[model samples]
Target: MTAVADLFNLKGQTALITGGSSGLGLQIAEALGTQGARVVISARKADVLESAQAHLAGLDVDASWIAADNAREDHVERLANDAMERLGKIDILVNNAGATWGAATADHPLSAWDKVMNLNVRAIFLLTQQIGRLSMIPNRYGRVINVASIAGLKGNGPTSQPTIAYNTSKGAVVNFTRALAGEWGKYGITVNALAPGFFPSKMTRGMIEKVGIEKLAERAPLQRIGDDDDLKGAALLFASDAGKHITGQILAVDGGVTAV
Candidate 1:
C-alpha cells in the first residue's frame, strides 16, 4: 500500500519545466508542486520566472527558477548545469517552451522557420539530450512530456494564421515523442507529447476568435474550448509512476477536436 501510494505521489522527485514561468507551463508547475515534487521552472524572462517562483512557493512545493533562452545552444548548457547544481537530479522533464507565428508558407521567412524550429523542435531535442546524458539515463529512470498543439493535428482556419513552420515543428514534436519513447523505454525512461487543442494563452486566441469559438465548439464533438482544469489529469497520468507502463504515446487534450 505504501509503495502504491509512493508511485502516485511525487515526493522526493525533482522536475524541470521549460517555459514554466507562465501560462500552461506555470499551471503544470503549480500542480506538480502541490502534489509534492520539487520543481525547477525556466523561461527567457527573469522577472516572469521570479513571479512564477513566488506562485510555486505559495503552493508549498520546493522550487527554483532559471532564465534561459531555449533557442540558444549556450543557454541549454547553462540551463542544464544550473539545474543539476541546484536540483542535483531531474527525475522528470517537461519541454513546454515553444515558439509560433502565423504566416503562409510562401510568405514565411527562412529566419522565421529557423527560429520556430530551433525553439520548438531543436531545443526540445537538445534539452532532452543534455538532461538525459547528464542525469536521467545514467539513473535509468525518467519521465519527459513535450507540449505540442492540435494545430499539429489539423489546419486551423483557412487564413487565420498559416504558420507553416509552426505546424511543421509541432508535427516534428509529435513524432519525436514516439521515436524517443521507443529508444528510451528499455532504459526505464518514458517520452511522450501532449497535444492541446484550443486553449487561450499567449498563443491561439487570435485564431480562435477569427475562427469563431462557437463554430469551433460545434465542430469539436466536445462542444467547448479547453480549460485549465482539463489539463491536470492527463498530465498527472503521464508524469506519475502510474504512467510507468506507458510510453511513445501522444495524448490529445483537444476537447474531441481531433476526433472529428
Candidate 2:
C-alpha cells in the first residue's frame, strides 16, 4: 500500500494555474507548491504576478509567474506554449481565471454577457484543449482542476444581485468539467471541478459588501465563509496522486451551503 504521505506528494511535478496572482488561485498554488510541485501562475498584471511570486518565494516554494490575459485566445495559446517551454510538461492545470457581470436578465447587455462567457467559459475550454494536446494527451497523465462556483448549482434568490450571465457561464463550466472528464479519462487524464461558495476576493468584493458578510454567512450551515487555507487541501487532493481515482466530479467547498 502506498504511504499516506506519498499519496499527496507532488515532488517534481509541474502545475500551471490561471488567475493565480491572488485569492483562491494563489491559495491552491501555495498548496501544490508547498507539497513539492513546481508552480507557474498567470494573471493579467505583471506587477501582481511579481508580488505573488515573491509571496510564494517567502514560503520557500519553487514558483514562477507569467502575465497573460487569459480571455484572449492568442494570449492563452502563448501562455500554454511558454509554460510548456518553461516547465517542460504540465502535470496539473488549474483553470481558475474568470469574470462576472451583474445585471438582471431583462436588463443585461449583450456585450457584458459576451465578456463574461468569453472569460469564464470559452477561455477555459481553449486553455484545456491546448494543454491537453500539447502535454497531457502525449504524456498520458494529467490532473485538470476547474474552479467553478456554487452559483452554478442553483439560482440566486430574488433579493440578491442579478448575475444571470455569470451564473449561466458557470453552469456551462459545470457540464464542461464532466464532459471533458468522460472524454479524456481514456488518456489517463482526470478532470474535476471545485464549486466554491462565497470567498472574499476582488471578484466578490462588491457582492460581499452589498449583501453584508454576516448575512451571507447565515445562509450556510457552517455559519461562515471560506478562508485562505480552506481551499488548499481540497485543491491539493485533486492536483496530487491522492485523488488519482477521483475524476468527473464536482466537489463543493462551500461551507455546506449547497447541502441545506
Candidate 1 lDDT at 172 equals 94
TM-score of 2: 0.99
Flag regions of model 1 displaced more than 4 Å.
1-6, 157-160, 208-216
Q: For candidate 2, give the lDDT.
A: 0.96
lDDT of 2 by residue, 1-51 (tens): 999999999999999999999999999999999999999999999999999
lDDT of each: 0.87, 0.96
Tell me, by lDDT, which candidate is best. 2
> Lowest summed lDDT over 10 consecutive residues: which window, candidate 2?
207-216
By TM-score, who's the top model here? Answer: 2
RMSD of every candidate to native, in Å, equals: 1.8, 0.6
- Looking at candidate 2, what is the lDDT of residue 26? 97
Q: TM per model? A: 0.94, 0.99
